[model samples]
Target: MAQDPPAQDLMHYESMAQDALRGVVKAALKKAAAPEGLPGAHHFYITFKTEAPGVSGPDDLLSKYPDEMTIVLQHRYWDLAPGETFFSVTLHFGGQPKRLSVPYSAVTRFYDPSVQFLLQFEAPAGEAAASAAEAAAPSPPPAAPSAGEGEAKIVSLDQFRKK
Candidate 1:
């Protein structure tokens, strides 16, 4: 006799877990936004989608980084503001100041090289629906590595899939 297929996930536990982790990013940014500024050597490298909803930045910047971009929050960044759903900040690009607004949902990775802490998030559902041509386009290169940076360690979720 043939066996039945395994049950599907109706609760979407993966999505829920991702949302909770994004909250962690939000909390960290909130802390950095305090008047005292980031305490100690704690800094952030935030990577996010440029096309994601609620994301806004300079037109030239969006063109240069059509897919995604990473920003460093170590020093010289200003106007750090974290809202309920999105965060905005000002950073200099080639000596020109530019403001960026990125929603929490757009963030894909958050790393603090100072403490070697990292968090990665799966792409949003909309990103997965892009056409083949779009997917084939080359992604922008990541920002330069900081001192003491190590090789990237990716965390896969295939083990959690139901057989």
Candidate 2:
């Protein structure tokens, strides 16, 4: 007897959920940009793919964090502009200021340690496969860390996945 094909996510619920969550990020940033600024000790740690499409930063910064990088947005940041699909901000690195533009789709993780809130996003299907393949290749030399680079709290999604 022939077996049926495995189930597929034709409804694209995952994409929808991710988009909605990104909206949450945008809204929070918008609120932070307000005159009052972030309220009650709220801060953010945004980790994103450096090489993802629509991401822009200094060449040195990109080379240092070729794959992924985390930025802390607590203090000493300015021009926190949020757009329809991307957000731009100016941050200091090594005593020099640099600007970065990151697309919401490029964000892999968002965390607010003050509130213990976290959101982890999976790479789109195609990119996930490509990233897995890239992982098999040899990596370049490790680069020095920039300012405000801190240890990231890792959370696995295996627990939420269906076996």
**In every candidate, how many clashes are there?**
0, 0
What would the per-residue lDDT of candidate 1 be over residues 1-163, giving only the tens digit for each residue?
Answer: 9999988999999999999999999999999999988999998888888889899989987776677777878767789999999999988776567899999999988888788788988776778657345658865444443323322222222232246
Which pairs of residues collide in candidate 1?
none
lDDT of 1 at 14: 94
State the lDDT at 101 in candidate 1. 98
Q: Report lDDT per candidate.
A: 0.78, 0.77
- The estimated TM-scores of all candidates read 0.79, 0.79
Q: How well does candidate 2 match the true structure in TM-score terms? A: 0.79
> Per-residue lDDT for 1-163 in model 2, tens only?
9999989989999899999999998998898788887898898888788888999989986786767777877766789998989999888776667899999999888888788788888764458987788778966534444334433222222333346
Q: Of the candidates shown, which would achieve the greatest lDDT relative to the real structure?
A: 1
User: Which regions of candidate 1 deviate over 4 angstroms?
Assistant: 1-3, 129-163
